[model samples]
Target: MTQSSSEEEEDKVEEDKVEEEKGEVEEEAEEKEHEEVEEEAEEKEDEEVDEAEEEEDEAEEEEDVVEEEAEEEDEEVDEAEEEEDKAEEEEDKAEEEDDRE
Candidate 1:
């Protein structure tokens, strides 16, 4: 009868150890899953920042092109005004010569 009682106590101790080991394994798996989720969130944020920067660069390039075109148009208008003034001066000189004759 004493031997039987000793065997029962040993079995109880083995069962407790097995339960503790299972709890530790479950905790480790939860921690690994949480870390992976955090890493994925960070990667998504980085991608958004890169896309914003690209859009700003494209807008700046478009503004530069518009300014260059405006400058070219202004130059053309100035040349046309100068040619009209020269024509008026020649017409006035011919009228003065006919009056002297």
Candidate 2:
């Protein structure tokens, strides 16, 4: 009878150890899941920042194109004015030569 009681106690101890091991494993799994969630959130934020930067760069490039077009138009106007001045000078010289004759 005494030996049977001792065996029952041993069985109970073994059961308790198994239950503790399972609890530890469950805790580890929960911690891993939490870390994964945090990592995913950080990655999403980084992607959003990259997208915003890309948009800003595109806007700056568009502004540069507009400024370059304006400069080209100014150059065209200056060229046209210079041509008119040269024509006026030539006409005055021709009139002076005719008067001398």
Candidate 3:
């Protein structure tokens, strides 16, 4: 009976050691998974930041093009107004010449 009790105690000790090892392995796996998740999240955030920068660059380019077009339109309007004023001046001179004749 004494030998049987010693054997049983040894078996219980081994079982406890196996349970401890299993817990350690589970904890290590969880740590690795968490690290992988954090890396993936960081990568995703970097991609989003890159995309936002690209969109901002594109918007700035569009605004520049619009401003250039507006400036061109303003120049054309000024030219038209100058031509109209010159025509009116010429018409007034023609009337004065007719009255002098």
Q: Give the least accurate 10-residue stretch of model 3, judged by summed lDDT.
A: 83-92
In order, what lDDT does every prediction score? 0.90, 0.96, 0.99
Clashes of each: 0, 0, 0
Residue 47 lDDT (model 3): 100
Off by over 4 Å in 1: 1-8, 92-101
Per-residue error for 37 in candidate 2, Å, reads: 0.9
Model 1: per-residue Cα lDDT over 1-101, one tens digit each: 88988999888898889999999999999999999999999999999999999999999999999999999999899888889888888888899998999
Error of 1 at 14 (Å): 3.0
Root-mean-square deviation of Cα positions for candidate 3 versus the true structure, in angstroms: 1.8
Q: What residue runs in model 2 are displaced by over 4 Å at the alpha carbon?
A: 1-5, 84-101
The weakest ten consecutive residues by lDDT in model 1 span 1-10
Evaluation by TM-score, superior candidate among 2 and 3: 3
Residue pairs clashing, model 2: none
Query: Residues 1-101, candidate 2, lDDT per residue (tens digit)?
Result: 89999999999999999999999999999999999999999999999999999999999999999999999999999999999999999999999999999
Give the TM-score of each candidate. Answer: 0.72, 0.69, 0.82
For candidate 3, the per-residue lDDT at 60 reads: 100
Write down the lDDT that model 1 would get.
Answer: 0.90
